[model samples]
Target: MISNLSELLAVAPEEIDVNEPFSRLGLDSAAAVGLIGDLEHLLGRSLSPTLAYDHPTISDLARHLGGEGK
Candidate 1:
């Protein structure tokens, strides 16, 4: 997820703090939708367009998508 987000934002992977909100990382609505599209392609599954808004942070989203305990 960090790698994907970093690539989307054109930032180093390490620069993305998983706990930070996407808005704080400069992800606007369009970019959030784009990220969802990228994730859908990579995961080969459909995802909600509002997923980013629902999760809000990388760690949260990762846990939700990965089925990790949150």
Candidate 2:
């Protein structure tokens, strides 16, 4: 997920703070939607459009997505 966000934001993966909110990471609605799409493709399932808002932070989202969160 960090890799995905880094790719989307065009930044290094190390620059992303898992605990930080997506909004603080400069993720807007369009990016969030794109993120969900990417995740859906990667996970092979559908996801909610408001997932980013619901999870808010990378760690939270990761955990919800079945990853081991930091």
Candidate 3:
């Protein structure tokens, strides 16, 4: 997911702290679309870039993708 973000926004992984807001990671509309496409390709399904709005931190997104815990 970080790779996708890097590819879309042209930002390095080291620059994006998992604790940092993706917006702080320098998000924009066009790059957001690119991110969505890349994520869909990687995840093999569709997801809203709005997910970024709700899950600002990458760790949150990882948990969301992980689904319910045992």
Candidate 4:
């Protein structure tokens, strides 16, 4: 997910902070929608269109998807 955000924001993966909000990384609505599609493909499950809004930070998103806590 960090890699995805990094690509979307045109930044290095190391530059992304798990605790920071996606908006801070310049995740506008279009980017968020694209991200959702990528996530769905990677996760192999259908996700809500508003998933990014519900899980605003990388850490929060991880927890939402039952991943290890950041």
By TM-score, the best candidate is 4
The lowest-lDDT stretch of 10 consecutive residues in candidate 2 is: 61-70
Question: What TM-score against the true fold does each predicted structure earn?
Answer: 0.89, 0.89, 0.74, 0.90
What residue pairs are clashing in model 3? none
**Best model number under lDDT:** 1
Question: lDDT: which is higher, 2 or 3?
Answer: 2
In order, what lDDT does every prediction score? 0.93, 0.91, 0.74, 0.89
**Residue 57 local lDDT, model 4:** 89
For residues 4-62, write the lDDT of model 1, one tens digit per residue: 88988899999999999999999999999999999999999999999999999998998
TM-score of 2: 0.89
Which parts of model 4 are misplaced by more than 4 Å? Answer: 67-70
lDDT of 3 by residue, 1-70 (tens): 8877776677786777887776788887676667667777888998886766777777777777678432
- What is the lDDT ranking, best to worst? 1, 2, 4, 3
For candidate 2, the per-residue lDDT at 38 reads: 91
Instruction: Single out the weakest 10-residue window by summed lDDT for candidate 3.
Output: 61-70
Candidate 2: what lDDT?
Answer: 0.91
